[model samples]
Target: MRAVRDFASGIVHEVNNILGVIIGNAHLAKKSSANAEALEKYMGEVRDAAEEGRELMRHVAVLAGEQSSRARPLSLNDLVINVTSELDPPPELDLSSEEATVQLDVWMAREALAGVVQFMAETKAVTSLRVATRVVGSAAALTIEDDGASPTDDELRALFAPFTKLDGRPKVGLQLTSLADLASRSRGYVTAGPREPHGLRIVLTLPVSDGTPSGDRPGVPLSKKGV
Candidate 1:
């Protein structure tokens, strides 16, 4: 019941934001019709917001199980490179020199990682970021460390739960909650903790795969812990 509410709430929150952008820009475009450059800019904003809403709905479909997972053999290095390349002012990367492959849905993996990265970069007062990928035991792991405001232990736990309030306002840390869902779907898990001295550390681990049964390949169970 809480999960259902949280899911619905997140969808509502995000949709409302997108709608605000669309509506605001549409109004601006109407008033700026006489000014070619300004009108073009407003219309472009509306188009981009609409496109974002469309993508959000697609992601919701996947979360609701209306879409199916499309797991395939993929190189972890390639996946990291492709996803990070799409982010503006992308994080500083320290990928392992060796190749590590994992079986997972590419879209889910990409979105989950991108969402986390973007959230931290935009809202967490993060000045620098370190994204590293490697093989830990039989799991392909991604560790994202950021020089950002350090959350307390309780705050770290709250990050993975929707609708947690901070500073007397609702925080849409739903990105991490969404991440938990996507990780579970990928047979992986996510953990977050305070980094030494300052900052935050988030680790996401998925089972390493070679198209064989992963029973023998130690997997990262759904749990949270320190880095």
Candidate 2:
């Protein structure tokens, strides 16, 4: 299937790119005349690149495993805060929420949310990655938005499909396609689109806790702009 091919392509592309960085650094190290400063610089680059590759592989492996069986009713808003805080993300990250408690495998749900937060953090042009949640009927929608990284309609169509580096940007990374897969396994759905005025937006919908939706609300804190 096209989906399978795309997933394969994405994984290969990202791995190759990281390997390229390591190789380039090795070449520089070989030519550095044994100078401590030059060797240190080259070694540092190699180490950093290798670490990134390691993290990617670890996360990919986590995603590769069977979905977590520990499903429960919990507040997604709280999950976002907990995960992002652990990341020490940019100060510009504005996380808000109304009430959005959904039934999900917390571990897998955390992984999916981490993918979104990590991708946004990597976008140098992004001013801020804003997150919010709202409840409607028996479902809760968590919207993650950015003030940068706008994609074309065509790009948007393939956003959750697979492939890396769309339009010269990290379109997916272990992107939405993986998140979609994880969400589906946990009985949820995810979608993407351009936000109003400009920017990228992703909304993940899941069944609400207790099958009864809470009222809609935005980030209530003025300081961090969180719920």
Candidate 3:
């Protein structure tokens, strides 16, 4: 009962935050009507917020068992590079390196990872980021480490549960929750905590792929994460 309440509270917190971004951006867009450049910028933020809201809804639906998991064999390293390469990271983040191929839902892996990276950028003055892979038992673990910002013990405890957020707000951390669920569905897991004396580390583990890569060329549609 307590756990359910906490999860509900976390979801409320995140939805409120995402809506706040949309509202704030909409106000800015309204106020910037006089400047074409500013209007465009504000409108872009508004669009981002709206897209985020839609994505959040989708994630929540999946978390609630409203969607099916489409998974396949994939190179974890390849998938990580594919997703991260498309996004612009924080200016200070030095992510240049790591790897293992695994079998999992590529969309889940991409969303789970990209969401955490973006959330970290929003909530922390990140100085550096490190990503790599390691073999853990029968699983291939995708590891992400940051050299700035830290989460408390309580935040760490709820990192993987549905409705939990790393920044402790209502800004939609469903990505991380989905990651945990995704890993579980693949017969693996996800874990996070403090790293050394600074920063944090998050690992999403999935079953290693025993097969070879598909023949699809690069820059294929989003379906390439896994067929």
lDDT of 1 by residue, 68-134 (tens): 3567766766766666676567789898776677886666666677777777766546678788999
Clashes of each: 0, 0, 3
lDDT tens digits by residue: candidate 2, 1-227: 98788778777888899899999999999899579899999989999999888877776776576766756666777766666665555434444445678876655666677777788767777767777777888888888888675788888777877554556456566657567876787688888888777778888888878743222222322111101
Tell me the lDDT of candidate 2. 0.71
- Candidate 2's displacement at residue 140, Å, is 1.1
TM-scores of the candidates in the order shown: 0.72, 0.77, 0.71
Models ranked on TM-score? 2, 1, 3
Over all chains combined, what TM-score does candidate 3 have?
0.71
Could you tell me which 10 consecutive residues in candidate 1 have the lowest summed lDDT? 218-227
Candidate number achieving the greatest TM-score relative to the actual structure: 2
| Ordering by lDDT | 1, 2, 3
Q: Model 3 Cα RMSD, Å?
A: 5.3
Q: Indicate the residue-level lDDT of 158 in model 3.
A: 72
Q: Considering summed lDDT, which 10 consecutive residues are worst modelled in model 3?
A: 90-99
Clashing pairs in 1: none
Task: Encode model 3's per-residue lDDT on 1-227: one tens digit a residue.
Answer: 87678779876877798789889988988988999999999888888878877866787676666334566677665665566665555222332132355666666666667787666555545656777766656667777777665778997887676666555233445667767777777788788988887777887767767767443223553452321
In candidate 1, which residue ranges exceed 4 Å CA deviation?
20-45, 66-69, 86-90, 162-174, 212-227
